[model samples]
Target chain A: MGDEVSSNQQEPEMSQLKPDPIGRTALAVEITNRLRQMILEGVMQPGEKINEKALTTQFGVSRTPLREALKVLAAEGLLELIPHRGAVITRQSEAEIAEVFHVLAALEGLAGELTAQVASDAELAQITAMTEELRQSYAQTDRPRYFRINQAIHQEILAASGNDTLVKSHELLAHRVQRARYQANLTPQRWRAAVEEHEAIAKALAARDAETTSRLMRDHLLQKLTSIRVKS
Target chain B: MGDEVSSNQQEPEMSQLKPDPIGRTALAVEITNRLRQMILEGVMQPGEKINEKALTTQFGVSRTPLREALKVLAAEGLLELIPHRGAVITRQSEAEIAEVFHVLAALEGLAGELTAQVASDAELAQITAMTEELRQSYAQTDRPRYFRINQAIHQEILAASGNDTLVKSHELLAHRVQRARYQANLTPQRWRAAVEEHEAIAKALAARDAETTSRLMRDHLLQKLTSIRVKS
Candidate 1:
């Protein structure tokens, strides 16, 4: 683990990641974001012990700021600080995954409801275009492209909701299970159904049917959970 | 009697107030909940400067844990940490109140739908009974009793959702606006309407009408927001 960080830089954009004179708190926050990205991208695997030494060197930071970053993540339930072993990525159990998804379903359902009511025409059109692009990516069998477009669809719904706190709360839970979400490999039948679900969401949202949009958003997430469960 | 703002040392009704803990972090968490309760109960007025000395004495803790507790509250947007001057409770703007209540409505709507689907017969019976009791409290013109039972009804619905994460997320937002929720001085007609809404919610939930239950829950909260806005 230590050798991995020492031998390879985690982010390609690390050259621009210089610690500022603004003090350790800001630096700690920067590291927290970088580390969170790492976790989301699966650069840091769950249950793996954190390589403090390598991160310190990679970020050109002292151990103090790096550890502070770890503490913040620990507080968010992303990392676990052990007595003797230092920080280990918290391995979420099945129950934890289900719990987070359940809340996320509700939050996304709210996003759908609000988006249906208030999304600008331009935003609705863009969401419709994104849904089309997601389908094309699926047709191309480009998983990474599909994943990016898929996430953009969800983010678009949240942004259209025009509720920052709700967006933030949804993002927090989404981050907790992001790795699982992106990694979910569905069977062909399930994949087709998932794409259809996204199309239905975009259509219902376009029709300004708040109830159908909300229900579709929720059921979409619950169906996605099955794929995540299959993958794990 | 005195010019002391937060000198209300809490009367007999709060018998479960004192929280002695074994560790600093636990003490800080306990103090956080205690402080949150104080804010909700209006013991600490929004925009009023915190009296550190008084809180330290009241909580029987040193400055360290109390300050830690204050920081947690600040992070939750319930308090603002000023430079040189101490903490001040965050005075929620009308916009902020509306935003929080909007999200709360969605969360409670989800709770209603889930409870309608999953609540035990005993739980629904209890909720129906609580609604009757709430009506009795109103009939007796006991505002305090009505307040307690009203909150209990909401709590019972959340409990019946069978999703702890949903409960916690809802609660985090609920605590943010609880003072507004409780302090809203409704007109007599509005109060009666509020009770009628609760009755409709209970009846819909009992009938397992998930969509109606969800919409009623959302509408009930939106109606409550009008009262809170009027109060402020």
Candidate 2:
């Protein structure tokens, strides 16, 4: 929660969010967004404690806005606040992870169904390209890059769904497990299976087979959970 | 934003959460939860601006924690923060409302599927009883009571899903549209259709007809949006 607090969040726009000048809510929102990014990126480990003084000092802010950021994260289920004490990034139990995966599967399944029914040809082509890119990443064994591309493909489908709330809700639950996914090394067999699954999903989506696309998308996410559990 | 802010938020549990006694994070969480409840309960109207000073004075706190609550609400899509100014409760557009209903339908669709597959006899009976109660409220033309029972039946299904994340995610999206539902006076025709839909949903659940339950649940929510739009 100090210098290690992911300066990737410290974009030029973020630096301009000085407190009091623009107002507290703006800065608080900025901090909340950045913290959410850090947690999702796995730069901040699950169950890692935040030293309030260090984080405030690191962000060049006071305790108030930092506390505000923590509150927002807690509501998002990305952080846990201990009563009368500081907070920690949340760690999901195996059962909790399974529950979240089930919900995400439903979200992605709906996204696929909607995308098949309405996505433009360009959107379908972009998803196909990402699926191909995901295959390329498979040979390299770079887990983070592969995971990022995989997420980009699902995100593309969600965007095509034309429902912002669907995307937001999916990401909120996805963030809870993305860190685990970033760290969980996949077995070679499972990696091949996931890649194959993506190929089938892309084909179904391109064919505009809404029901098949929906079922494939749902199965894809559930399989991801299976892979994580297998590897762990 | 003062007395009109809803004293119902000031439960005995809430009064115990003073800023200094239990710590900043705890107080912030309390304020965020209560604010969320107010928004959902329709005590806080959409498009209503939060008077930070008046709310702080009323809640007997400083601006720091109250501002913290605002940040959290903004993230949940229940509030919008204006740059340099404070925030206001979010008002959904017709388009936005449609988008949210689609997602909530997907969520409740999954909930119905899971509940059909796994919910115990007791849980199913309880849900059926709520459905009967909903019918009773319909006869009385008590909109709130009917709406509350309608939500309870849905909540019972979500609870029976055994997926806490599913329940949490559904509520987050449901909150976005619930204020509108509470105020949208339904036509008798639409009301009768909704009641019929619930009866069918309960029958599907009782018979363990997963596909029908899932389809019925999704259609039920979308039809609710249709009802609201019809009345408006």
Candidate 3:
């Protein structure tokens, strides 16, 4: 649940390896994470060709490792491998974007339900802390900073729900939509509305009302979808 | 959506191309579909190595196309690509399985909500028809037949929701878990209970009560989780 910084390595060094039998998996993960960040940050635009030869050379790895990394990204819905065209960054139509948010709403609703059912004091405390961080970022009118914290709070809810599949699928869909960037251009009014929803979500979690929490969560996600303009 | 089937690939030769060009993307997709079926049907087992050269010969494609297909599978969570180990089928831990189910529950719940919101009389009729099919199968005590219809009813609900992302994620997770065999092993009494739950789900959907539909869906999924052994 770390920020994009952890995922921003464009030319990861392959010189070093962790001392473990599963080190290869770790390296593959590093590659996947970095590629995901690059895509999300717009360094790699949607539908751009992924030149495997260039990637292999840039990462100082062979085609074998690079191929593995590409596969991992493809699974995350960040890339699509086009036959002779090779791997390309994923792009979504407006219809696809709408579909993603519809799913997200449902997923976040489930997260809210689970969070209400099982969020411990510590989990709640962590969420509260993120909410405060979001508030500060909002006050400073820093979009990227605010965006990071906002993303963290949403992710925190997903993790606290104790469902790995939901988290992974949610992240996959989110990535496919290039994260919508809806929250990035947050208007002051919408920011306040978002803050209010966070407060409601927190309160619902505290009360452990699954129904209310689920409803609030769905509403929260739908609000974001409505605010964001899907790219043509 | 349909049972994971082995593509016969024996269709009568069709026209060279349809109205649209046979885009590079389509070739990658066709290759990926074939590879996915292989893995799901256990033609390719967990940890079984995939040789790019061998696949190139088998699929009658170049290394570039084969590599792209591997990348596609890798993205679907069906194949794991190691740096040097190449690609292998994915295996899940018990914890991971539980995690997948938890997410499935949420996604299905979402489907239920949307189904209630948008499922038309025709869609409800379709589900009802499937329910009858299930009843007949259950009466015959043909577990496999019952399972197929059961899968259809659920997929129908997902499709009726009109959310592609939900359908895609739900289908992917369903394939990965492949819990039909486990469910097929349920005792007669438990099996009856499961069928009864399905009946309730069908009725709730027919009634178009969003709350009841969602609640029934969540409960149905939770029941399966509780009843199954969830092999470690």
lDDT of 1 by residue, A1-232 (tens): 2243233533343232443333434565688789989987878777677879988999999987677577667656688765445777766667679878988998898899999999999999999999999999989988889888998999999999988778877877898998877677768888789899999999998899998999999999999887788774
Judge candidate 2 at residue B193 and give its lDDT.
Answer: 88
Q: By summed lDDT, which 10 consecutive residues of candidate 2 chain B come out lowest?
A: B1-10
Q: Which stretches of candidate 2 lie over 4 Å from their true place?
A: A1-26, A41-44, A139-145, B1-26, B37-45, B140-142
**Which candidate, 1 or 3, has the higher lDDT?**
1
Best-matching candidate per lDDT? 2
DockQ for every model comes to: 0.13, 0.32, 0.32
Question: RMSD for each model, in Å, please?
Answer: 12.6, 9.8, 9.5
The superposed Cα distance between candidate 1 and the true structure at residue B208, in angstroms, equals 3.3
Which pairs in model 2 have colliding backbones? none
- The worst-scoring run of ten residues by lDDT in candidate 3 chain A lies at A1-10
Per-residue lDDT tens digits of candidate 2, residues A40-83? 88677666777889878878888887887888888889887777
Candidate 2 residue B46 C-alpha distance from true site, Å: 3.2
Report, for all candidates in order, the number of backbone clashes: 0, 0, 1
Summarize candidate 1's per-residue lDDT along B120-209 as a digit string, tens digits: 999999999999999999999899999999999999999998887788778778888888776788789999999999999999989999
Comparing 2 with 3 on lDDT, the higher-scoring candidate is 2
